[model samples]
Target: MFTPVHADFFNAPTLELSRNLLGQILVHELPEGVVAGRIVETEAYMGAEDRAAHSFGNRRTKRTEIMFGKPGLVYTYQMHTHTLVNVVAGPEETPRAILIRAVEPVEGIELMRERRGKHMPMKQWTSGPGKLTKAMAINMDYYGHYFTEKPLYIAQGNPVESVSVGPRIGIGNSLDAVHYPYRFWESENPFVSKFR
Candidate 1:
């Protein structure tokens, strides 16, 4: 049984929340069934000043408006054909967020396998940001949703004994921001997207 993490669980600073998120369970209750995964990887996006962040220089739009909302708000966005998920962090108007990069299947594995196709290896199912969202059935519908609420929410899980940190991936154009050591993951976790 999983207990929903409260709003206070996300009150920590954005960078701290990113590391703290490791080892927590991300649960999504679909009409099809309940699917959950233990988070293994995450990346932090510092608001405004960080060039790699969507709200860099405070560029707010319909899409980024939710980022400026209260902590624990869900921020889902489309990257090409894939939809990725992020957890809103920092105080209101700060626009900071932590991207859920990967997770290890904990429940509803069969459901996730179906979404990812049976032929694919289990590790490949939720081993990346885009891949995890699809496998867990998390889409744009979850945008603006509160992580403290049901249907979709985070839950407590076993603590990660060792965490590895490194620079985030996929945003090389941000220059110096790309080299920032903001990515964190459970050490040696096979479900993590990539090892540092």
Candidate 2:
């Protein structure tokens, strides 16, 4: 049985939280059924000073206001046609967040497959940030939600034995921030995003 992680679970430093989430389960209790996945990859966005982050330079807008709130809050945003989910990290007033890049399907496989539509490779279902959110039915409605509660919450899973660190994907315009080794993933996980 998986136990939901409390708000304190996200109280760690942003980088640590990125790594710690490697093997955790991201559960979304949908009306159709419960869909979940084992987190395999993540990216850390150190707010304000981090040029690659949405809250860079402490810029606060309607979409980024949630990032400046308490840790463990859900920060969902749209990237093109897909909705990406992030876990608010760092202390209060700090806009740091960890983007959930990829996950390995755990529960509600049929539902996930149906939501994703058509029969494709299982790894391809949630191998990318946008793809995972689509498979799990996570959308803009989850923005500013708490990760410590039901419907959507993180749960304990297998411990990560080995981890790999690398630069995050995209955001090539962030200058030197593009080189930051802020991406963390489970070593040799096939479900991890293809970019790395």
The candidate scoring highest on lDDT is: 1
- TM-score result, candidate 2: 0.97
- Residues 97-176, candidate 1: write the lDDT tens digits: 99999999999999999999999999999999999999998989999999988899999887799999999999979999
Cα RMSD to native, each candidate? 1.0, 1.0
Which ranges of candidate 2 are over 4 A from the true structure? none
Residue-by-residue lDDT tens digits, candidate 2, 4-74 = 98778888999999999989999998787889999999999999999999999999999999999999999
Clashes by residue pair, model 1 = none
Error of 1 at 78 (Å): 0.1
TM-score of each: 0.98, 0.97
Global fold similarity of model 1 (TM-score): 0.98
